[model samples]
Target: MLDIKQIREATDFVRERLASRGGGEESLVDEVLELDERRRRLLAEVEALKAERNRVSKEIGRLLAEGKREEAEARKRETRSLGDRIAELDRQVGEVEAAREALMLRMPNLPHESVPVGRSAEENVVVRVFGEPARHAFGPKTHVELCERLGLVDFARAAKVSGSGFALYTGRGARLERALIQFMLDLHTREHGYTEVWPPLMVGPACLEGVGQFPKFKDQYYGVAEGDDPSNLGRLYLIPTAETVVANLHREEILREGDLPIRYCAYTPCFRGEAGAAGVGTRGLIRMHQFDKVELIQVVRPEDGYEAHEAMVRHAERVLQLLGLHYRVVLLCTGDLGFASAKTYDLEVWAPGQGTYLEVSSVSNCEEFQARRMRLRYKDCQGVNRHPHVLNGSGTALARLYVALVETYQQADGSVLIPEAVRPYFGEERITP
Candidate 1:
């Protein structure tokens, strides 16, 4: 959630940045300001009424002590009316506050000033490219074709068992998935300075809200609603990413100034309701309702956020680098930035068979947007509590990374050669037909 005070103080600035997001978001700031004014006005009225009631009660007491019974009764009646007025104003204040909060929750974070102003992915700027897309003497086979010929993933049965947008890996495929997860987790924790955490896959609504996933993107998640379900967590939602859980580890917390930067890496089976674009090139591991991902999270001092963002981009890029995959880092413009992120960088790996660059990870700097929602604060050197900047990235999402790996390494013999970096973890050099 954005700081209301920021909007109140910098209305035009916030509106202009939000306008760059291209959603008529300037109007949202106006609404928030209007509601804020009403809420404050109501609160002021309630305070005045309360004060008047107190003064009247004191006068009533004095009148009774002076034996002016009639005067005391009149003042006592005035106090009653003042109390009733205060109650009504208090109720109005609560309603207005709720309306303001709802709007705040729905508002996207203001785009960082440095972000390029654009309208979509087409306008995203490619910051750097690593290696070139390969050419195959024999026509390249898609990951789907590769998986089928090699008997790796059982997509047909995944549909039978759980319907579409799901996959069940067998033998080498399952092993490969596990190896990728372990590889990324180890890389992030052992080298990237991130602490490993295993958070609950199912989380409460507040957890989703704290991470800016609720109210707006609720349709993209799986959940158990409130009722007599007999579940320990009556109302719960399965996390869409480990970021959703790991970032909340310090939710509603106040940290020491020395612990300015907190890094965490977690591996989780993320469940989603929305599959990606439909039809061609969307088959196989390119899009799945349930997929494995190793997520990276960092909370740092406000000033260090951009530095952390750059380092996070490097960390994610290293994974693809070690795997020897050809990929590019694209800096997202304001229009393409995630809801909670002030800025983001997407890593797209070239899938020769798929004949496209598949996004394998998105490293985002959310600034203090999420910390404000989570009420996560850290005491500064001045002993002032302030929201710390938060960052999250897919150390890499596995499905498409899996697709890129197989499609890029497929041999004419209908087998997939495991990348050398993952060879030891996969326990084999190739998945032979």
Candidate 2:
């Protein structure tokens, strides 16, 4: 959520930045301002009525003490009218505040000044390339073909057991997934200085709202129906990413300035509807309703936000570097930015078999957008409370990462050589047929 004071003071600047997003939220400024004005006006009226009622009560007490029964009753009637009026104004204030908050919640974050002025992913700029895609001795097979030939994943049975967008890894495939998770978790915790957390797979709607997911992407997640959960958490929904839960671990918290930067990493199964995307790139593991990902989040001082952004991106890039994968980092254009992110960088890994680049992670700096919603703040040197900035990224999504890994390392003789970094965890991981 944006600071209402900022919007009131710098309406033009907010409008211009939101315009760059090309999401049609620039007009929201006027509506928000109107509601804000109404809320303030109503609150003022309520306060005035309360003050008047206080004076009238004093007068009524004075009249009753003076043995003037008729005057006291008449003053009491005036007080009752004032009370009724105040109550109505209070209700109106509540409604206006709710409306204003709803509008603000729907508005996407203002783009950072450094973000490119573009309209789509096509306009995104490539920041850096790691290495060229590896050359193959034979016609490379797609991840689907390799998985089938190696008896790694059972797509047919997965479809039968669940639905079309699920995968059941068998034998070495399951082992590889576990190895990748452990490897990423260890890398983030030990070297990247992140605290490992095991978060619940389901979260309340407020958690999603705090992360800028609810009331917009609400339909994209799976919810546990009323009776499905024994605990009955009021229709809790499956987390779309570990960030949905991990980033809000400090919701409604106040931290000391010394603890300005806090890092966390979590591995979780992400669930999404992927609505209407079946016609796009639903090939193999490219898009799935359920997928595994190691998510990272950082809470830092406002001035250190961009620096943390760069560091978090590096933390994600290190995973690919250790895996010996060819990949590139791309800066997202304004229109391509996520709803909660002021700026974003996507890590695209090369897949030899697919002959295309697939996004494995997105690192972003939200710049207090999420912190404001979470009511997460810290005390500064000046003894003032201020919201902190939030940075988040995927250490890597195991599904697409898996696709790139298998397709990149497929041998001419039909075996898949595991990357040396995960060899210790995978335990002789040349998944031979």
Off by over 4 Å in 1: 225-234, 275-277, 280-282
lDDT of 2 by residue, 1-433 (tens): 9999999999999999999999899999999999999999998888888999999999998999999999999989999999989988888999999999999999989999999999999999999999889899899999999999999899888888887789999998999999999999999999999999999998999999999998888778887877656676546899999999999999999999899799999999999887767532344888998999999999999999999999999999999999999999999999999999999999999999999999999999999999999999999999999999999999999799999999999999999999999999999968898
The per-model lDDT (C-alpha) reads 0.90, 0.93
Candidate 1 lDDT by residue in tens digits, 244-328: 8899999999999799789999999999888344742345787788899999999999999999999999999999999999999
> Of the candidates shown, which would achieve the greatest lDDT relative to the real structure?
2
Candidate 1: Cα lDDT at 220: 81
Please report, as a residue range, the 10-residue window in candidate 2 with the lowest summed lDDT.
274-283
Model 2: colliding residue pairs: none
Model 1's alpha-carbon lDDT is: 0.90
RMSD of each: 2.2, 1.9
